[model samples]
Target: MTTQEVANRYIELEKQGRWDLIQEELYSDDIVSIEPDSAAAMGMAKTVKGIDAVKAKGKAFNEGVEEMHGGYCTEPIVGGNFFSVAMGMDVTMKGAGRMKMDEICVFEVKDGKIVKEEFFF
Candidate 1:
């Protein structure tokens, strides 16, 4: 699949709350996720290898969000085996209140599977 296809697939999976879909479709057997600095997760970029780890991370993210809305794809900058997804994510929390964070999510695809993923928010 093309970079646009890869990017679009992620957006779709996220919207549908299918972390498993992202694991099976976009990610390879081993995947690494680089969390953002401002993110609640520790480490700016931690390599969470394998599908289970990725899924756990996804669940954790979902649980953290008190109310999440206003998600969109602003722009997709595609390249060979990679796509830079510019997005807007509105997250409301019990304590922090509502905020919209512009993010750049990068996917590393090999043979149509995302081997590594990272986000800068």
Candidate 2:
């Protein structure tokens, strides 16, 4: 798949909240995930390497949420092998109270798989 194809499929799965499927189908084995430094305060690593670790990180995040009120993922803007999307969510965390968070997520595609993803809030 081309980067545009990957981006479209990502948006499709994202709209359905099918994160597991997105990762399973689109991520490269050696994928890298990067979070902002401030994420460390929320018990998230600044960087995660490998698809397994990334999946674990996503699982941990989902586990931390007490309730998901709503969320949105914007259509991706593709350029070269990179695509970017704006995503936001309103959720209640296990220990933290309900809050709304928004972020810009950028993904790099190579060989029809997402090789890197970085988030900025």
lDDT of each: 0.75, 0.97
- The number of the candidate with the highest TM-score is 2
Spell out the clash pairs found in candidate 2. Answer: none
Give the poorly placed runs of model 2, Cα more than 4 Å off.
none
Candidate 1 lDDT score at position 83? 83
Judged by lDDT, which candidate is best? 2
lDDT of 1 by residue, 1-121 (tens): 7667887888788778676777888888878777766664532235577788888877766676799877777556778888887777788855668888787888888877888888886
Regions of model 1 farther than 4 Å from truth:
2-4, 11-19, 40-45
- Superposed on all Cα atoms, the candidates' RMSDs to the truth, in angstroms, are 2.7, 0.5
Question: Taking the tens digit of each residue's C-alpha lDDT, what string does model 2 give over 1-121?
Answer: 9999999999999988899999999999999999999999998999999999999999899899999999898999999999999999999999899999999999999999999999999
Model 1: which residue pairs collide?
26-114
Q: After TM-score superposition, what is the CA distance of residue 75 in candidate 2 from its true location, in Å?
A: 0.6
